[model samples]
Structure formats: C-alpha cells, structure tokens
Target: MLSLRTRGKSGIYYIRGSVSLNRQTIDVKEFSTGTSDKDAASHVMAQYQMQLHNELLFGPTAKVADVTFSPEM
Candidate 1:
C-alpha cells in the first residue's frame, strides 16, 4: 500500500507508504519539490525509487558493490 501526497505550502511531494514482502514491512518515506500534482507524484515516485535502490540495494544504486554497472549503461 503505497501512498503519495503533496505538502500544503511547499508543494513538496511526500511518500510515507508501506510495502509488504514475505510478511515483512518496508515503510518508505521520501520527498521532492514540484508545483503541480502530477509533478509532485512523479517527485515522490522518483524519491522512492532512489531510496529503494540505495537502501534496499535494488540495482546500480549508491553503494560499494562487488559488481557495478557502468554509469553510462
């Protein structure tokens, strides 16, 4: 159950949602800046994706991995 919302004033996107995998809860929180609702949604989605990749070690994220893909690739 992922949820996305925009801040009332700053119009920043926020993702304070949860995901269940194998009975495990992965609660993610992320934020981004934008004006329109669509932009805010996209911002949250992008932030969440970055979090997943970096923290959860998804793929080609920011970490010291034994193997990594080329940045250009």
Candidate 2:
C-alpha cells in the first residue's frame, strides 16, 4: 500500500510503497510530490500507482519499436 511521509523538519510530502509481483517485492520509496498539500500529493500518488500497475500488468513498456531508425554510413 502507498503511504505519505514527511522528512525530518521538512513539511514536504512524499510517497512510499511496495508491491509484490512474482514473489518479488518492489519498493517504491521517497517519491516526492513536490508539495505540502495532502490533496495534491494524493493525486500524484494515484498517477504513480497507475503507472506501476500498467507496467506490472502489461510487462515493461516499449517505445523504441514505434521509432524508425535510419542506417548511417
């Protein structure tokens, strides 16, 4: 599950979490939302979570296949 935390005296909010896939635990820690507002941070956290979920559900994302490469002499 995802969590929010503050570093020391800093009021900035960050996201930390872990997801288990294929018997391996991937820890996503200290992801900065760049804001002190909890609402904003929650929005950012949701985006990150969706990204992670897509990667896990569909495997690694590949974009190079969409690009055309030209041969160099």
Candidate 3:
C-alpha cells in the first residue's frame, strides 16, 4: 500500500509504502516528492511506484543490462 502525507509543516508531499520481495516485506518510511502540489506529487509517486515494481520484477541489474546490452544479440 502507498500513501502521501505532509511533514513538519513543509507542505511537501512524501511517499510511504511497503515493498514485498522474496516473500519479505520492507517498509519504505518516507521519500520526499519535492513538490507542494498534490497533482505533481501524485505523478512523482506513480513514476516511483513503477520503478519499484520494475526493480521487484527484474532485479536492479536488469535495468542496466536492458540499457547497455542484450543477451540475445
């Protein structure tokens, strides 16, 4: 699950969620979206969620491999 919240009167939205990997769940406390606008923060959150999902499915190294090299070549 993911959620957005403001902290310390900063008015900036932050992302908080948990990621499940290898049957273990890890809590992501807070990541700053660096924006005060909710729409922009939601966009940032969506992008970040996709990134986390990719990392979960393909592992961190797959991103580098997909960009730099192809095994089927």
| lDDT string, candidate 2, 1-73, tens digits | 7888876576889899876667656589678899988899899988777666656655655233334788998
Best by lDDT: 3
lDDT of 1 by residue, 1-73 (tens): 6666777776656666675545456676654444447765776676665555454444344445434577875
| Lowest lDDT 10-residue stretch of candidate 3 | 61-70
Best by TM-score: 3
Candidate 3 local Cα displacement, residue 57, angstroms: 0.2
Which RMSD does model 1 reach against the true structure?
5.7
lDDT of 2 at 61: 53
Q: Which runs in model 2 stand beyond 4 Å of their true positions?
A: 8-10, 21-24, 62-73
- TM-score between candidate 1 and the true structure: 0.46
As for lDDT, the candidate ahead, 1 or 2, is 2
Question: Which residue runs of candidate 1 sit more than 4 Å off their true CA positions?
Answer: 33-40, 43-73
Assess each prediction's global lDDT (C-alpha) against the native.
Answer: 0.59, 0.75, 0.81
Better of 1 and 2 by TM-score: 2
What's model 2's overall lDDT?
A: 0.75
